[model samples]
Target: MPLVRSAHERGITTLTLDSPANRNALSAGLVGELTDALTRCGEDDSVRAVVLTHTGNTFSAGADLRNPPPPEALVALLRRIVTLDRPVVARITGHVRAGGLGLLGACDIAAASRDASFAFSEVRIGVAPAVISLTVLPRTDPRAVARYYLTGERFDAYEAARIGLLTVCGADVDAALAPVLDGLRRSSAQGLAETKRLLTAKVLEAFDRDATDLSALSARLFSSAQAREGMTAFLERRDPAWVL
Candidate 1:
């Protein structure tokens, strides 16, 4: 089944991650599907804003290393969300880790369930969170990011909101996000697009002049010895035995 699912109505579209068994992992095919969906949404004038959510307990558990995606493919999908003309909001519930956190950052607004937790756990497996670095690094507080990235520790949704990772928090995340959607509905699509463009331009400028180097770095991380070991261990249901 395609990982990306959708329900469109009244000029607002909700795109859902649907691979519940795998916690909606970012497989290569899934990345392609997401990219395609986002492109279609952008081209559709009726879609004024997008609300991203997921099926089951996890919003997303991040990438499935057992079936890894191409670095460039995943990166492009995230870039699309970041640069999309319409407003994007993440409706986060349950656990969101690693690449999942990247999706939250890419969106213009995020609302999390009161019980949800956010984490950056790539380091626990011996590799850096390269694919998510550009998005998460800027949006999250430096100290909070440092603690999580360095230790692979988890933080609750309220902390996520406190650090600017989420715009609202409530037991009913959908209810919390409804006002944001209403605000989007009241605004002009062109105005929203221009605002998003201006914000993203600032984030884009943070990278060095040779920003392609970051892409290269992500590719390298995917192919690294540590990543290989970590992915193998995960599939085997064992602790990764990597020498630091």
Candidate 2:
């Protein structure tokens, strides 16, 4: 079965990340599937808005520690999310981490449950955010990014919203998302497209200027000895040697 699933109704398309076993980790196949879906939605005039969500309690655990996807694959998926003509809304639940935070940052709008938590954990695993920084850095509160990026500490949904990482946090995430989606549905396709373009112009500029270098940096870090050890230790449920 495909790791990503799609459904459309009333001009709204919902694409769900469905690999619950790994908390919808962004494997190569999953990213490819998601990118393709987003591309299709961009082309479908009937799809006025798109919801990017997940099926399990854990929204996404970021990269697959055991078999991480290429940095280019993830970069491409995030870029598509940013450039897709329709409005993309992330309905976040459970917890999000590392590169998953990048996905959240690329969305035009995001609503997370009050109980949901987020973290930038690459530092703990001996790598930097690298390619994801292209999108996440622009969307996040600069102050919040400094602390969370370095400390690798988790923050709750309220903090996420406060930092501009999320549009809103609510006791019921779906309830919070309803009106946002409804409003998008009411927008003309061209209106949403142009508004999204205006909102993402800076991010798109960064992508155009920095994506190649960032992807290279990501590939190098992930292949480094320290990062390999960190990923291995994490998969083994142990601390990397660098951990004090």
Candidate 3:
């Protein structure tokens, strides 16, 4: 079955990430599926906007440690979201973590349920959120990033929005997204495209300039002995060697 399911209505293309077994983690296959789905939307002139959502209670748990996506693939997928002609809105229905936060940051706008939580979980596992920083650091508040990136503590949806990780939070994410989609449906395609370009030019420049360096940093950390032991301990449900 496809990892991503795509549907269209009223000029809106909604791409639902469907890999719930691992909380819709960004595995190589899932990223590829997402890229393909977005490419299709790009080609279809009728697609006025896109909504990225997920099927599970967790929007994503970030990169699947057991079967992670290729660094290039993950970065490319994020770039695709930012560069797509139509505005990309993320409907975050649940908790988000690590690289999953990257997905949220990449979208032009994101709305989450009031109960949704978020965190940068990489540091706790002995690796930093290097690759994801390309998208996330640009959107989130610098101070919040300093704390969460280092501590890996979870925060609520309201804080996520306050920190600029989400555009809005509500009892129902769909309710938050309704007005956003309504506004998009009213925009001329050309206007939307140009506006997005204007909004994303800096982010696109960062991707071009920093993605390679960041991906390399992520790869190095993930392969380090500390990260190996940390990931192993996490998978084994035990404290890592460094745990006090």
Candidate 4:
């Protein structure tokens, strides 16, 4: 029940993640509810654009390890974001880590507050970003993925936008997002769908052949003794022994 509220009005549909205590981590139910809401928005012609945001200080901390979604849910989550016809905007503030990074990358437009920071933290958690990596890395420059993935460093909003992971970064995030949504409202839904499809096709074409390579890397990363030691150290609030 990590997803707390879903509402639509005046051509904008907003879905909010409710697990603020855990920094709005993604739970199984959250994924299902979010997927369902996004699907509903896609089918409803009245919906002009989708806004994915959260209610707490942190936009999303990432997928909850205690309640991980199944592989099917993970696949559906990626496909829903990838195939959605309307423009989707991710509104980020505070700390967005791990799978939250994925959600940002999956959206058509991402606007973050100046205070917002993001990270790909799966490496430290002893797991691959997996489904998240699929959408997240493609939206960003491929070369930086290895550095961020291996280092698990937290990056600020400006750096995110500079690297192409985020589209917009500013203090007035909601204000910045307003005009973008208005522009989307002016476009024909069919045209948006076609554009999304063509663009997605082109992006996928580049990475399709390397799917196995990424997966192998993730598997090895997750299984490494260093991953386990690092994750344990993080959870225990101690310096990782694996660090130089």
Candidate 5:
């Protein structure tokens, strides 16, 4: 079965993260599938926009601890979303953590339900949100990024929106997305693509400038002794030795 599922409505293509069993973790396979799906959307002139969503209570639980994609793959996936010709929007009604927040940041717009929560979970796992910073840091408030990235504490949708991590949040996420989708539907494909290019130029520049160093940083941290212990403790459901 595919980890990512694709569906189309009118001029919009909706790509859903479907690995609920693992909270839609970004395994290599899932990343590849989603990349391919977006490539298809980019090539199809009929596709005016794309909606990225999920199938479980958690939109994504960051990297798949047991089968995480290489940091480069994650970086490529994020860049794909940023540069895809059609506008990419995130429709989230669940929790997002770590690398998942990268997806939210790459999108041209993101809407979430009021109950949705977010966190930068890498710190707890003895890693930095290095690769994701390409999309995240450029879009979110620097002070807010400092707090969440260092503390790994969860924040609600309202806070996410306030800090520029989300475009909107409401009691009903789909209803909140209605006008946004309607606007996309009414837009000329060429106009949407050109405008999106303008909006995402800075993000793409960041990708070009920092992706290599960040991916290397990610690989180094994930292989370190501290990271091993942290990931082990996470998997074993116990506090790591350094935890007080």
Candidate 6:
């Protein structure tokens, strides 16, 4: 079965992260499938926009700890979203953590339900949110990024929106997304594509400038002794040795 599922309605294509047994974690398989889906959407002129969503209580539980994609692959997937011709929007009603926030940041717009939560969880895992910073740092408020990135503290959907990690949040995410989708459906394909290009230029610039270093940083950290202990403790459902 596909890790990512694609569906189309009117001018919008929806790509759902469907690996619910893992809370839609971005494993190599899932990343490759999603990248291919977006490529197809970009090639189809009928696709005016794309809605990136998921099928579980967690939008993404960060990278798949047991089967994480290569950091370079994650960087490429993020760049693909930013550079895709059609506008990419995130419709989230679940928790997002670690690299999952990068996916949210890459979207041209993101809407979440009040029940949704977010965290920069890499720190707790003895790694930095390095590769993800390409999309995240450019879009979110610096101070907010500092606080969450350093502390690995969870924040609500409202706080996410306030910090620019999300475009909007409401009691009903679908209802909040209705107008946004309607706007996309009404937009000319060329108009949306060109507009998205303008909006994402800075993000693309960051990718070009920092992706290599960040990917390397990610690889190095994930292989270190500290990260090993952290991952082990996580899998064991216990606090890591560093936890106070």
- Among all windows of 10 consecutive residues in model 4, the one with the lowest summed lDDT is 202-211
Compared with the true structure, what per-residue lDDT tens digits does model 5 show for residues 96-144? 9999999999999999999999999888979899999999998999998
Any runs in candidate 6 off by more than 4 Å, and if so which?
none
Looking at model 5, which ten-residue stretch has the lowest summed lDDT? Answer: 235-244
Better of 1 and 5 by lDDT: 5
Displacement of the residue 135 alpha carbon in candidate 5, Å: 0.2
lDDT of 2 by residue, 1-244 (tens): 9999999999999999999999999888888989999999988888999998999987789998776789888888999999999889998888999989999999989999999999999998899998889888898889889999999999999999998899999999989888887788788888988998999999999999999999999899988999989998988999899877
The sequence of per-residue lDDT tens digits that candidate 1 reaches over residues 10-56 is 88999998889988888877788888999999999899999898999
> What Cα-based lDDT does every candidate model obtain?
0.83, 0.90, 0.92, 0.77, 0.93, 0.93
Candidate 3 lDDT over residue span 1-244, tens digit each: 9999999999999999999998999898898999999999999999999999999899999888889987889899999999999999999878899999998989999999999999898988999998888888888889988999999999999999999998999998887788889999999999999999999999999999999999888889988999999889989999899988
RMSD of each: 1.8, 0.8, 0.8, 2.6, 0.7, 0.7
Q: Which clashing pairs does model 5 show?
A: none
Error in Å for residue 134 of model 3: 0.7
Q: Can you write out model 4's per-residue Cα lDDT over 124-174, one digit (the tens) per residue? A: 667777757677767787777778888888888888888888889888998
115-221: candidate 6 lDDT, tens digit per residue: 99999989998999999999999899999899999999999999999999999999999899999999988888888878888898888889888999999999999
Candidate 6 worst ten-residue window by lDDT:
189-198
lDDT of 3 at 72: 86
Each candidate structure's TM-score, on Cα atoms with residue i matched to residue i, is 0.94, 0.98, 0.98, 0.87, 0.99, 0.99
Candidate 3 TM-score, true structure as reference: 0.98
